[model samples]
Target: MTSIVTIARLGAQADGIADAPGGQIFVPFTLPGERVNVAVSGKKADIVALLDPSPLRVTPPCRHFGDCGGCSIQHLEQQAYRDWKRQNLIDALRARGIEIEVDALVECPPHSRRRAALTARKTEKGLLLGFNAALSHRIVDLEECPVMLPSIVEQLDMLRGLGLLVAQTKEPFRMAVTQSASGLDVATDDSGALEGPARQAAVEYCIANGIARLSVDGEIIVEPKKPVIMIDGVAVIPPPGAFLQAVENAEHVMAKLVVEHLRKAKRVADLFSGIGTFALRLARQSEVHAAEGDAPALAALDRGFRYGDGLKRVTIEKRDLFRRPLTYKELDLKFDGLVFDPPRAGAEDQARQIARSTVQRVAAVSCNPITLARDLSILIEGGYVLKRVVPVDQFLWSSHLETVALLEKPKKRR
Candidate 1:
């Protein structure tokens, strides 16, 4: 049995760090300054008993708090969790000797997640449906997830039952459920392995149960038949697996921040533009070139562009920026500013290319702070100055943090 110890600090993986006799031990579900009896589960340890709980440790809001992998810090006070994420970003940048004001943490409401990919498994007990347990392949059984929107949580039992039926077929499958402004979508595994009657059964079951759209193997078979979400009475239909920011209201907030930063620009290039979320919105005030690698996403953008007035001013291009970054010469037509919403692996070569570009202003949106810091270091070394860094709590309660930054070219020194 491992000796109980006092957790001194919080680690990167949302675990508590304790000083052991020989070295340091990382313990999960134990907060800083908390003395807990731990059971060494594997290479790491788990909290078995809390001898002295930290003042900051509060009862988790969710019933499935420890079991569901969607959130790690639900036990931490809501306000403290926000502060920790803000400090995390600040510390990450400071490690690179970069300095900037981290704006107030934008808090996401509890149970506001609109998109999730839950795993399902057939066990002796029944069908298990939920996120994979932290650092384990075991699927956590969840009656209802607190972090998901109520509409989604309401359908938990139905989803589990469906999963059980699918599992009984002895076929492997995964589900991607998304809640849009209009209705809901349920997508099943589309590896092209399941076909004939079984495939038909899944589709029929979803349609009969009121699933708006059904995708098999990444292809949208059932058109989104639900009523569109109206913004100012304008109906909008987001594409399947399109990069919609997960938080319910954070998308609008992030768009506002980006627009405020790029207000004066006449022309802007939006890289990794998914379904023109920011690009189309930005086009209302400036010309935009929406560059993305995925053909289906671009096609969806093209369709949206045809109908929306704001998108009419935006141009679409399908290019894999990772394989071949846009060079200064390639971007012969100079723009006043640039915006990029890159994936988790933050833009490396693209950031360098932006540094070399003639554009005077740049707005970057990043999901991972470590990669964001690394990319920022490259841009700073190449003579770009970070003006502001805003930490957005898009994925609240989760370890993930999203940030948007404003950068400008520094004056050349003699």
Candidate 2:
């Protein structure tokens, strides 16, 4: 039965929050302050039919709206979406007892920055080729994706063809597409666990269709392997499946911020320094020790540093910061600064250790703001003062917020 409901507020997932007679219901595709007749679907009532739409709800730029799971806020105007993201970050931090003045949200140029993406496998009907449907495992056939870089969008047809071939073979596959200024890289997985003959066929199709630089199961199958992307005019070849920041331009901004923050210090320790993005750049101005858990990424960073001229000031260390905290004896030499970029979980033990360390300045880059706020509180309670919190909107149209914070130890009392 279809029910008429009034949306109350916006939820974290960009769904409209509405109060039902039973309880609070989240309706997708319905904006706040809108009265709509919706048919419920699944456990949490989804808006099946919108009898009335909100004025704030505008036509999404992408034709794949309401289907593609990648973007939820496309129905909102661009400026409004940006404003909402900024407020979401502020509110999230406030809920954690941290106050932030989000005066200027760093804007990301649409369709300009994404470097790596994973597309979904196509079904037997040969329609969907991008991402799974919203809140469902069924793939949504995509004709176009507005958020992707222009180059990637152009290759959609080829990708669809590959997906169809894979589907016919009854093999599951995951396609990793990475693009840079130099060219595109298409990686296929034919391991039978994911995608088998279909993946192999995809690579063959790419080669036959003039797609260069392909990798299957982390090994290059075609073209001499090289970094297809350059950062600040410096070519950086990331290790296979190594963690590179998915957004290209945002990475540049993040690296610049971290490097600028570390420039004032004489010695710095970069934790979780994937491919030495921050460590290498900061080494130009100061000595840096790049510590990472992944050996392959660390090896690639070391190799890159060997050929680079400006980053001679950097050193490399392979350590899992999560498994064990850095002890005083381990860091016998006091560092002037510490730059850490941990995964989504944030650096809890590492942050605690830094709070106790002799480092005067700390720069923390986090992919999750909630964890960032919690970790920041720990540092604050540990005698460190929060100077500034800069929020970077790396993942647009999504609730995810990336932030960089600068912290300093309090001056000792006389």
Candidate 3:
């Protein structure tokens, strides 16, 4: 069915929304108050014609803006985009019956994304490597990516050539590329088994092309140079496909908040501490015990701490927090400060334990607002007062939002 409709507002996913005869319809690449003739089907609308354009819409920077899944809110005006992001945090917290003043969205500039996970496949026609298209599995073969660092974008062709040489099947695979102090750290997965000659060619490609390191299926094929990332002042060699803050600016901003919040404490417990992003910095002042499930990530953190100079005692533990959250007794034993940066699901089970702990101060970092809200509500019920909440736009021009929340549990007087 084709009909014209006026977009009322933007939804949580950065798509323009309309209240139709059905429940609701989502139309991508369209802004609020734009009357667009769309092909409607099953609560989704594809804009056939722009009958009216919204004043808030602006010219997008990237040529592949609409086709690429990398960004969604790039067309929206700057101030509007910031408000919409901050409002997302507010709304999420409100849904959990918790109300607080959310700080303004901290903006990140374009061309600063230091990490990217791209799709790749060797096709009969040619090589296809780039981000997946919006709402589809097709790869948008990118000529230029405005959101990623030029360091990564400049080597796309070289990367595709390597992909073609190592590809074992026609089906798609994944390539995770991270920019480090030395050079690019490339990891390929689901590309099938690379036999003897093919693996040799991929290794030669990395060495000849000045690529720092290349790993296939979690195995390092060639490491012409060690891939190192300097966090605060310590250097770390991240494991294959390790988690990193997408943008450098956002990582520094979030780190500053976390470090300052727990600065006064003598002992700190960092749960889900990946690669010691915060623990290494925190160790400059406090005795830190970092726990995580990924053994490789924990090993990297331990190495960074052991080699870092002018730092306090920092210990690493490999523990699956989702399965066994640290109990309140364990936390209260020696730690006065706590920090946990969990995945998108948030740390519900761990938050329950923190609620019962006597850890004086805490810094909660999350990429999902709804899950963060749920955890914060849990901490509040356990007598923790939410002191500050700062929303960071780590994933720029996308639906995702990152938040740094500070909370303090009061001391019992004798």
Candidate 3 per-residue lDDT, tens place, 1-414, comes to: 899989998998998999887778999989889999999989898989999999888999999998999898889999999999999899999999988988888888889999999999899977899999998999999899888999999999988998898789899999999999999999999998987999898988889998888888999888999899998899999998899999999999999999999999999999999999999999999999999999999999999998999999998889999999999999999899999999999999999999999999999999999999999999999999999999999898999999999999999898
Candidate 1 residue-wise lDDT, 330-414, digit = tens: 5537577788889999889898887776677788899998889988898788777889898888887877988988888855568
User: Which ranges of candidate 1 are over 4 A from the true structure?
Assistant: 41-43, 123-126, 164-172, 190-194, 224-239, 310-312, 410-414
Q: Least accurate stretch of 10 residues (summed lDDT) in model 3? A: 15-24
Estimate the TM-score of every prediction: 0.92, 0.89, 0.99
Candidate 1's TM-score reads: 0.92
Judge candidate 2 at residue 25 and give its lDDT: 80
Say what the RMSD of model 3 is.
Answer: 0.9
Using lDDT as the yardstick, the better of models 1 and 3 is 3
Local distance difference test, per candidate? 0.76, 0.73, 0.93
Candidate 1 lDDT (Cα, whole model)?
A: 0.76
Model 2 alpha-carbon drift over 4 Å, by segment:
41-43, 122-128, 161-171, 190-212, 328-332
> What residue runs in model 3 are displaced by over 4 Å at the alpha carbon?
none
TM-score: which is higher, 2 or 3? 3
Q: Give the candidate number with the greatest lDDT.
A: 3
Worst 10 residues of 1 by lDDT: 226-235
